[model samples]
Target: MLRFAGFELDQRRIELRAPGGEPIRLRPKSFDMLRLFAANAGRVVSKQELMEAIWPNIHVGEDSLFQCIREIRTALGDEGRQLIKVVSGRGYLFDAEVSGDPASFAASAGLSSASEQEGLAQQAGGHAAATVAGPAKKRQFSFGLRSRVAAVIAVLCAVIGFAVAAPMFAPGVVAPENTPTITVMPFVDGGSDPQATSMATNVTDRLADGLAKIDTIRVVTPRSDVTTASLANAPTRPADTDFVVSGELQRSANSWTLEARMTNAATGEVKWTTSVAVDTENTDLALQQSRLAAGVGHELAVRINAVLYPRAGVASPLTGSTKVVVEQALASINQTTRERFTAAQTMLESALANAPDNLDLQVTLSALQTRGIQMNWYSAAESTAAESAARSRLERALQAKPNYLPGLEAYCRFLTATNNFVESLVACAKVLSLDPWNGSALYQLGLTQIQLGRFDDALANFKQADRFDTPAVSRWTWLLGIGWANLLLGHSEEAVPWLQKSIAITPASGRPYMVLAVALQGSGRTDEAKAALAKAMVLRPGSTALNVAPPKRNASPVFLEAGQRFIRTLVELGLPAG
Candidate 1:
């Protein structure tokens, strides 16, 4: 019997007992997990090691392991994870002290080996007579026809069970087919100034070399310069060129400007273009070249990626001035008022009117519309219209810019809200590929993972969003996301503080209150839970367990049932049935 934290784990019987000697039931996996923890008490167990130990040779989602851990915590009444601590970005540790006497404990629980049993029997002065009779009894036993027939039937059933549930165990998304190819033409010196020539060559070389690092694209540098003459006019298609990148260098006194453009090699249509200006008088020439090349290369890679991966990878065709307008409009997204939302909407609409083909404006407008739908800032009819409009605009934006990070992140959030988990995961992943530290994309990734019952993974992603410190991390939804994941994982103590933080950030919203109610309820603070629910009802009048859907989730049966239970708790606390 291994003892720790007011409970004893009887390894032989595979049971845990409370201090009062009452048995605490645990599922087989939960018991095994507890056993592992007891064995390695005070040691951090990596997720990989835990998974392999508990489920050798079985292909299971990370969520399954998370579920087992949750169950073990519940059985131990370790809601705060004080005894079983989670080490962020690492694994878990059994922090409690555990000790036990092996042989006597095993013998008491009927787990002693034959030799040990014999030794115990001999010590008790009653073993040989019982053992001698046991062998004679075994000799007299025989397998009858009924027993043989039953064994055969059991074997057949096992075979049938294996054949039934194979497809559900399959792997995830397939990778892209082929790598995209891009040709970087030498930069043209558009000025008579002698400094411009060397600067142009350096910029072109640095840009091409930097862009070549993106594994998704094949960056090609031609053996000979593709002249500025061809770039100025419509250039002929180069062999095997999917896209063509060319730029011109201009110098005026101490300042230099590089104007770069990428085009469709076949149609000679401009796909992307940007200009960077730097003062060579203040900065070293090498530093100026490196910084300029890095900027140009980053933009070029985004454009190429969008074309290569059509689902995501579109750059917004907006100048810095135009981008500032969109950023200002996006600021009102989390304010939770129709007036604020509409003001942002009007700003985007005006910008779109001026530049109808601008992908950045379209993307911003679409995202604003989707946010309205999510926040219920629009009337029913208006929401329906907005959803349709947003989808259409986002589609057009994707076509125009293909891998626009903001556009993809917004689409991913929209997809998750609309119950499209698979597509959302893909889109969110694309956003991460372009900018790994994008908090919005990380948040979207967490939301999709939540719907799939991968709360542990979701929580990890949410923490990553915080670490990235993206603007989205400041949004109330970030804290709410972490809170909800903990609530779903049965970590109510942990959930309460996160939900409380969310409420502090955005008290006007109903979601934090609703989730806070559940966390409070789970923690046995019934009166506080009731107050939270009342606040939720006040914020969203006439809202109910039935009408207020749970975050577009279609998870495992256990999670679905747990969701129902949570709702039932809310209803019992006087939430409306409607």
Candidate 2:
């Protein structure tokens, strides 16, 4: 008798008990096969050995052996043969522990001692000789006693019910604690709609993004991991991650229902599972989507944190005035050209009034004001006033938090826009020194180098920017910078691929196509270059092909000539003169 994984089995009486105390019936051969496995726990029992133990004289087919194994698995809750794993081409093994008091049962059964059992036949022969009679009569008496002995064995089996029941009462050993790492796999769409798959991928990506914000947890991006494909395969261990989060999405009418499960990757043991439904017919799809994303992110974070760091508390950092101000500022920035600057200024003023010491808001205001000045969209007096106000705010922000990277980067941009390229370069270098992997700092450094006409240095900084785990916008910007720098160096062939990659990553941006046209024209692909320039014009109508403006302070004449030549090629490719 032995018990494991909520199942109890008695070898003596061939009885199986479910977790709820219900008897599970099985075929005779299935019971025998299970008994053999339980008796020799933690050992690999060969098929030939098992056959001889179960049927000493009868010959059985391979299919019969497999059928019996299947029946035993069914009786044990289909632990998927995990408790009794089948080694390919090497028979079966029972990996789990088996416990029972075999000695006590053997004593209670009044069974012969090991030596006596071995000598039973010889002793029986001696007794037959003493009860000698006619030869035929002696033979008949011996045979009758052998039949009676088999009957006695059957009666003794019925009397020892406790032997079969002992394993049922025995407690199971607890498993060891695990340090779990979770990976959320992309969801699968079971419905007929193919767009549902993309929706699922988007949801998974958003969940991963939200989780990545937490400092304690390590989240892998979907682009790098193939967890989604693993879930679709549904192997014994579907994903190679430490813990796998997989789900299915189905559309019903105008809503979507998601069913998800988190399981241990090694054991396939389920830790958590739930179903959530969201109405797709909401008046504002974006708000509904955000709600769903927040719900899932918060719930999963809470669950995982509870298990890993139960005492740690979660804080709502963005709420009240902070949330309101941030939302308004973002909305303002997304407005059309005519209203964007005024709307941004208004929101910034309001946010500043509420959170006077907030460094982020101060820096954002400075950057926005600097952009207005650099674009020459404001009057000279207005631009001067804005630049003065921005410089004052940025200085105050640095005074409050000297190590603020965002403030440092914003101040560098402000200096660069005001034609203080040397100061901007020093500020960007300081940012990089503090945080070597800072993408914005690297981008600022690259832009400063380009303005100073250090084309080679600019190319190196742009490559470093891309090497950082940067956002999509920064990545595109770095690639565009690299393309322009390569064109200046006369490596037009090298510039085309980088420029095309930039375009592929961000097709709506006009900068990559603009640079690509110069590279194409320099490489003498005039027709293609013209096509590229035309596309750029469609994207940015007033953009010029001539580098008419003088290089910023500290720029070299030779590098300036190179840039002008590239611009001339763009003009030949037929871009508009602004």
The per-model lDDT (C-alpha) reads 0.64, 0.57
What's the TM-score of each model vs. the native?
Answer: 0.48, 0.43
Q: Report the alpha-carbon TM-score of model 1 versus the true structure.
A: 0.48
Candidate 2 lDDT by residue in tens digits, 316-434: 23356766766666444322243566777778788778777666677778877876665454676887889889988887766544434556667767766676664565455434423
For candidate 1, lDDT tens digit of each residue in 75-183? 7876445777654223567998777854454344333443543343233212211121121110000001123243233223222322321121111111134545677
Please list all clashing residue pairs in model 1, or write none if there are none: 306-313, 312-403, 313-402, 313-403, 314-401, 314-402, 314-403, 314-404
Q: Supply candidate 2's per-residue lDDT for 420.
A: 63
